[model samples]
Target: MQRLVLLMLFLFCFGSLHAQQTEPKKYLVYLSDKNNTPYTIQQPAQFLSEKAIARRQRQQISVTTRDLPVNPAYVQTIKGTGVEVWYTSRWFNAVVVRGTAEQLAQVNALSFVKNSRSLNRISSPSATNGTLAVKNSSGTSSEALNTMLAPGDYGLAYHQANMLGATELHDAGFHGEGMTIAVLDAGFPGVNTIPAFAHLYQNNQVIGTFDFVTRTENVYGANAHGTSVLSTMAAYLPGKMIGTAYKANYLLLRTEDAPTEHNIEEVNWLIAAEYADSAGADVINSSLGYTVFDAPSVSYSYEQMDGNTTIVARAADFAAATGILVVTSAGNDGNKTWKYISSPADADSVLTVGAVDSLGVVASFSSRGPTADGRIKPDVVALGANAYVLNSAGNLVKSNGTSFSGPIMAGFATTLWQANLSKTNYEIIQLIHRLGSKASAPDNTLGYGIPNYSRIVTGLPTLGAEEGVALVNPVTGNDLIILLADNWRIQLTELQIIDATGKLILKKMLQPDQERQTIDLQALALQKGVYLCRFISGNQIATIRFVKL
Candidate 1:
């Protein structure tokens, strides 16, 4: 009798479970048109902030229909089906809702409903406990004695900052003041409580915080990746550490979910980006990238890295179109099998950053790229390997990834932009590319290489006097030959080659009208490393860097 009762109980539970499984799942309903919208492009002030409007006015970008909100009547009709509307996307003219099959059938019957797709459901890894682990150190402790360094003292981070000429910008009083940056990343665990960020809080530089993953205002919980990333740009601990844009205002946004990887996170990012745009953010620094996902079926192949295909990439471009500069990481996938940059980084207008060491050499793990459309990726690079960052505990730590590099570059870019308010975003991006170390010879490894802010700000040296110059057979066992442009018989006053440390190793005083010159580096017994060749023709000077095998 007892065994029979147990069997009957199991049967009843199974029946109930099966019945519940038959219920409808949530779907993302894409709308066809926004014909019934109450808002209009002429009244952009309703949706866009004053700063946002000013940006558009300064850039001469006009408001369009896309800037208007989605049709409210269409949304109300969908909600009438007894389904709870979760979120709405103005960019896609869509809404996400949870409803039963019968309710969804009613929604599909509406003339405005274009199509609906089921939202992907995936289980979170137990190790993560539905939260991404904080990689940086975090906690409260007594302030160390060395916490009060001079304002100009960058401590261990000096090399990274100096590499991009950030120190020079800071010295020029362009420390990103009057500019606002939106940092979009996984999480920022202890930003409000950490002493390293005490200045940011004290000065009220942290203008706002939002968690898109949980749809809440509390972004101070999920993980510390953002905290570390932010430190690269905003940390102001004297003597101990200093960020690139220590004086800049910031908006902290949690867009990436550390515990789970899904297509939804991309949507979350898009939402956060729109928020940043509406909030009048001048620049956005996103260290997040997407290629693979927890659900293998939804993963993006290498070929799909084209700038226009991915949703996030399209959104990034849209963000740029709004007169906001978007800076993103190039991904740390160089040493892996899928050794190409991730989406959004592939977006043509976005400033994608790669990683390099203190010596200005490309990091082995920095993602390489020649976009699907054949454009050189990683518009620029910065010090990312063993990059200095502050943990939540208000302690300095060394971390490695393109994640840190992107913000470092972004911070510098902010200062640069602050210095030149008249320049458009497109013009600024082009200037940065032209100012990179390898701007003229960019490749897949380190596109355009590192940038020098001081050089860009002071005006790049003019090369008008000469047509072209090249180091024939750059890497070889024989003598290296310097080739000048055809019909260019300019007098060569002096030629010098220096080592990586700026030590002059070879010097030659050339005769007048010697257009072509040869330097036998083997006779100098130079070491195998990178060197810069400096050529002087009357008042014009040009420098070219080459590596020795």
Candidate 2:
């Protein structure tokens, strides 16, 4: 009776229950083990590319049996059962096959098979016919202060990159050259024809393309979402708009069948990640994440987002283990009732990105987290609110979603990594964590807060830099200014000045809206000596010393 109820309800990715009468065309069949696999860890050269092996070698990651290819003999047997095997995953030891319920049943009964679950595929005209192009007028909505080196560089995309301190990296000649980023998303409609991407074709910056959903080399013409997302990183239109990683190589892989929501997409992500690994990609940017499905029974609960429960999350972690940095979008569910990060974002090894406005304020729609295991997620945030992206028609426009934010960070990270080649992927993540404005106190809302670019290159501890407080340095006798991070979430409750002998020289109460405080050495007739300034809040205190001239 329970089996019939589940069948009637069409349970999806949650388990191995087969559909009763519904034609779940695709299925993921997990194998018992890689036993009898022809490949061995001794010769990873046969499976992993030279560059992939070099990456592992640089990171001191060893080649194990887990890196071996799936047993081809087992796959041959599954094919012998008349089921069309489309893809195989070595990480999950699984195969995605398409067949009738009866034919799949025979393959599932094989001794080597551990379990099988039906994957749903439902197509809608709006998503497939390119009618899902989101459009917004060219308007400015930003509160970020960026240091632009030239007006010709970055154009409108300046605020997004500069907000995260990426402009400094760009100015330092790290335009992501020699780095490769694999973008796994839905269809990219205008990538091949868009004017903004002409430079990519001229320079051969695009390494390859693949459609995991349709199983083809062609990755264009299904949805515009990927096109827009790619524009945030790959488009190279100087004096108009330039992507953060415009000089880096890219692999476009379509894994999401946008019209439907199901667990098969996660399997597709796993497959694409493997392909990227074999293709020698250094970074993987996944803007898609799983949360709910058409069938509520198969939908993921908040508990399943514990980083290990979801197959996609595990795949992300495995991809990261291969010496590749996996960056994903923390789902845009903050404003919704479900309100939490989706799968893959919960993955512990991935750099889960969240969305914030150009002004460094967390977006209302950006997902929140402290994972089910109590780990702070959304390692960082970027400009996603009214973010500028080129549409499928090759026109620069505006859009909203953590989808855009993830790619922005992905591109900046590429440039940053390119500038510093010796740093491991995890080391890069840790450095970003320490440079954030809120490094002293990371919260669920904004993990480590917005990163300061000046601090990244200088490697200096500027006053109030780690405390989420922005203070203008080189204070003179004229005035002093301070810009609080966020809307004063890291409030400045009070400020105290202590003289050379630890004598309390001055005390002042500060309101959350104080915005700035002026202390003049000339006005107070203070001596020219070193003095300690303490910025205190209810939660913590940050102190800095400055010598008065």
Candidate 3:
């Protein structure tokens, strides 16, 4: 997992002209408060070179900051010292300072300063321009399909299980048990009471929620997109349809203020994402897209769709660099003349998601992209046509958009991460691309076809001190026992027995340290036959074939 960080926008790009004078040196100075308590002081002026100020002014950069002390009087001394002040947060009790080689040495020589570094921002492409809008759900419900449908029934599910690399993660036991996802979107409607969400509530998975739109904690607004997205990851069912991640936690953030279009909503999203980060979210699933604004003059041009031009795009990229998986919808504009992805989706690091119809064809409404920088996008796809969701009136409904597809992919990403705790965001992404391209080839429509969880299951490196498969002998009539191993080294945290054809027969939670555990096979409504026993420990995982005598 990447370390999660979210950077808010200031819209100032500082430019400095290097002087030909003796090349300046940079240094990191640790300023000790001398006392353990938090402290604040004006930034020394001797640190900012004269050239830096001209650039700051040109960039409209302001010195006043709540996160850092910015007294002009104190800045003068640091002038020409080739030093620069980057980020300062009182909570961290530290201010990042930068200066040319010599200037850095001078700043470090001063007292009361803490630490300094050669400040470098991670480079990312510009964000897309477009808005992520969720349509109203039609009051309807699909008959409980978990019992009747196989994972292959939904193109998205099949992609994850057999195509992408999702089945492997599920087998590794990273069904997102302890991870937290902050879903920033429209309203959740009746998520709290929906049968699809019952497991989340019963398992205490719904840790916290808020509505930035209404300034309230409850987010059951009339929109059903949020409900559908949530269900893709958190819905729990045994022997029926289980989400890609059956046990992940969620934080619903209602940031969309429908009926009103204002720049403030973007700010609201920023604040909401900050709140999510503070809450220790492992992933941020935002199906919302942004592009044209209510004000035509403010609307973004194709060139401006460069990820760096948009405030939200910058923040989204920063969020990914920080380690949180920031997933967003590519937008439903394929049929339009623009036919391009929306903002933030243009963001380079973001996992821009598109939608695929039932037959694996790209949904006509799913956004198209060859980002401004020429990066292929809509990194993945999932079912979005006539998707299932919950309405405000506590009923299931159907809706369609790249919106539904984003969450479905997010659910798979979370589960994948849960399975391979050691895998970096880049590696996870590469694996996704690897699986898809290996099966077929990459294209703008689907960067990596869909993820396959099974490859990861059989391919992840081995773990623990023990090795080899364990044989379990039946003790009595209709007896069943699971011979477990710390295959992932984290432990054999969970086990699920299913028929070879993919019908789930039983589910069990096993202690990581325990090697042998007995499960009541007959109690699980299973018939005498061969079964696949899935084991999840950590990133390492494996499945064994067994016969239920």
Candidate 4:
């Protein structure tokens, strides 16, 4: 009986030891305070770059506790407890760590530790079977490389820029110069060596890079999604292809782990955003979105996409509120069961972009949404389907996803902001929304539609005289009245009304004194979409937008 009892005790001890060895889990340890931190709000220069501080000063934003770094002593104490610190978020006052249950318990016992929660169970890469792996290529096609390197006109790319009136913006000398953009994505494997990015390298436009996934500066060794995404904004192989913001500087940050998806990536994104804010990024383009995760237990539901629930969504809002223009993709899940946008894309203040085709039609695969809170999401649309992008193999490829669309819009937005340096980020966002194709009539499929940069630029306060044209009941059933401001009447030479696709639907040569005329579109059988009315009076031109219901 004594021998049997001894054998049972040995088996129980062995079982406990085995469980302890194999069951280590990842956790997010929330800290109660930033007390005794060396940084302070008054010493903003220490935490924020000169440009970042300049932006804050221009916008009248104040430095607060959120800007302070996490206490090093707390991190050190957690590390001393044998818990490996994965990442720390100053925004949330928390640190992510990996350790056994016993170690986590010890961390929880510390006075500074507020609370801790299990993020998810860590599994081997093989165990995941690419469940949540980022869909991007790591290898380049040789044929594509040769074809892409050959000089050609801005072939397929012109359509994208033209659709949003970005070509005109570029012509006006607003090509995102003197702007800084931060791209957070899964990775950027060949960005350093790509021929298309040579200008960015030569001009020192690639200002910074970091891998939050691995906690290293080696961000150019992972997946190619970021490389393709960055190409939409920074690639500058003139004649062949040019990005929307090729002249803008960039900071590349890898927040998504292509091999896995978990809540931790959201935390990583928040941390990276804070880093970008400190680094003085004028625009942040994040092609990464989160909805589902490898661990089913921790996956977010559609209800959580209310623009405030998810950690990443909150972070995106914070980034926007802090004077940075945040742009995120509206996820590629239109055909899936969860046919709606994911977090960060659902963020209210951030510009959530949806995917459209070269013909300016919403892509079937583009995510749609009135966010869980019933706010019209995807603030604008951009050409993402068959979007031209430079791959890791130095080849221009046609990529399809809102991932490309967000960066394209972001680059253009930076250019717009560059032109209007006096405008605050919020004002810029509002202007972009107000200038969209369907601003008067927004829906979940493509909220606000594509932006009209040409119209926006023409309407800027710095621009000469404001166009006195206004549409009374812009969304009219059949009759549309073009009201002219009661200013000195100028002889109307030619009036042209064009559709969203720039197709001239009606052209009329007006009499010299014909002012405030009403056009009856019932005769022409107009469809329900946005249209532009161009008025030519001598050398002066004024364009007004109206909607046909």
Task: Please give, for residues 155-241, the per-residue lDDT of candidate 1 as tens digits.
Answer: 788888889877766754457776789999999988888877886666667777787666677788888999999999987766777
Global local distance difference test of model 2? 0.78
Candidate 2 residues 1-549, lDDT tens each?
999988856656334354444343788899999998889999998888777898888678998777888899999999998877788888888898877788888998999999998777532111221111111211121222122346466778889977866666666555776678899998999889998887676666777778787766778789889999999998776677888887777888899989888887888899899988877789999999898987732988998899999989999999999999998999899999978999899998988889999788999999999899999988888888999999999887889999999999999888767644656788778867776778888888788777655555223234566656655655655454555655444455666665544345666766666566555545557776666665656524455666566
The per-model lDDT (C-alpha) reads 0.77, 0.78, 0.59, 0.78
- For model 3, the stretches where C-alpha displacement exceeds 4 angstroms are 1-172, 237-242, 437-440, 457-549
What residue runs in model 4 are displaced by over 4 Å at the alpha carbon? 1-24, 123-153, 457-549
**121-143 per-residue lDDT for model 3 (tens digits):** 21112223222221121112223
- The whole-model C-alpha lDDT of candidate 1 against the native structure comes to 0.77
Better of 2 and 4 by TM-score: 4
Q: Put the candidates in lDDT order, highest first.
A: 4, 2, 1, 3
Residue runs of model 2 more than 4 Å from their true location after superposition: 1-24, 121-149, 457-549
The candidate that wins on TM-score is: 4
Q: Model 4: which residue pairs collide?
A: none
Q: TM-scores across all candidates?
A: 0.75, 0.76, 0.59, 0.76
Global CA lDDT computed for model 3: 0.59
TM-score of 1: 0.75
Compared with the true structure, what per-residue lDDT tens digits does model 4 show for residues 192-241?
88888876666667777777767677788888999999988877766767
